[model samples]
Target: MKLYDYPPAPNPRRVRIFLAEKGIEVPTEAVDLRQGAQLSEAFRRINPQCVVPYLVLDDGTGISESIAICRYFEALQPDPPLFGKTPLEQALVEMWSRRAEFEGLLAVADALRNSAPAFKNRALPGHDDYEQIPALVERGQRRTKRFFDVLEERLAHSTFLAGDFFSVADITAFVTVDFAGWIKLTLPETHINARRWYETVRARPSASA
Candidate 1:
């Protein structure tokens, strides 16, 4: 079994951090996305979807998507329980993880993809080429700012997004917070709670993984 990764990408970083936190190491092959390596025929055969953070199991089962890959490891090693321990905690982690993806990560992605020259005809990821929407850039920026506000409020009341323990929710949110910086979007100084959460998560050794 091996993992396909592009270290600089946000999604792959999520999986790396997850694996590091779990203390599980998988053989990894880097697919350089910057040079359009993912579109190569060789990689397309491995992952038809043509995205990184993909895992190919020994039996040839391919798992794409960061959360799905993380889930595999969570099942493989249940200790430390990044997904969460109790049923309630699991549900909450799932909920907040989705929020981090949809509300936080996707928002920043939309803004970046729609406005950056590197993503010119690729507003969305995949095999198809789609033109960037100038209007969505503004809308995405607005949504991302709101995401910060939401996180600030949530962080103020809980030690982490899912509560007292660090879990997948925190990982997703932490990655989102960093990904936002690519588009030059950052947490305002006034959002102390969110900033505090960012600092705490950034300090983790797994964060560098």
Candidate 2:
């Protein structure tokens, strides 16, 4: 099995961190997003979605989306229980993971994609391109700040996004926190709980994966 990845991209990094946490190593081929490598006909045939963090199984079936790929690996090795050990834990992990993706990661993506010249007409990822909405930049920034606030509220009471144990929710939240840096957004100093949680997760060895 192989993973098509772009190392600098946030979504791919999510899968990388997940694999690291699971102690599973899959061979990877770098798809250069900056150079439009993912848009190539070769890559399009492999993944019609034309996105990075794609996994191709030994049977040649392709999996797109970071969480989906992570889920596949989780099914392969359930020891780490990144998704969750119990039904309630699984629901919480899914809830917070979606929150991280929508409230945090997508917010950052909106700002970056709409403001970066490199993105141009490619504001959204996938097969089709959408023109950037200049106004969304500020809106995205505002939403990202709100996401930080939301995280602060949640972390102030819980050790991790889901609960006591680190799970996929933490992975998504951790990646989103770092991705915010690309847009020059940061967790405010006053968000002590969120900042503390960030530092704790940042210290994990898998964070660098």
By TM-score, the best candidate is: 2
Per model, state how many residue pairs clash. Answer: 0, 0
Question: Which ten residues in a row are the worst by lDDT in model 2?
Answer: 71-80
For candidate 2, give the lDDT. 0.94
Q: Clashing residue pairs in candidate 1, if any?
A: none
TM-score of each: 0.98, 0.99
lDDT, candidate 2, 7-29, per-residue tens: 99999999999999988889999
Model 1 CA lDDT for position 137: 92
| Pairs that clash in candidate 2 | none
Candidate with top lDDT is: 2
lDDT of 1 by residue, 1-209 (tens): 99999998899999999999989999999999888888899999999898898999999999998999998889889988998898999999999999999999999999999999999898998777899999989888999999999999999999999999999999989999899999888999999999999999999999999
Compute the lDDT for candidate 1: 0.92
| lDDT, candidate 2, at 123 | 99
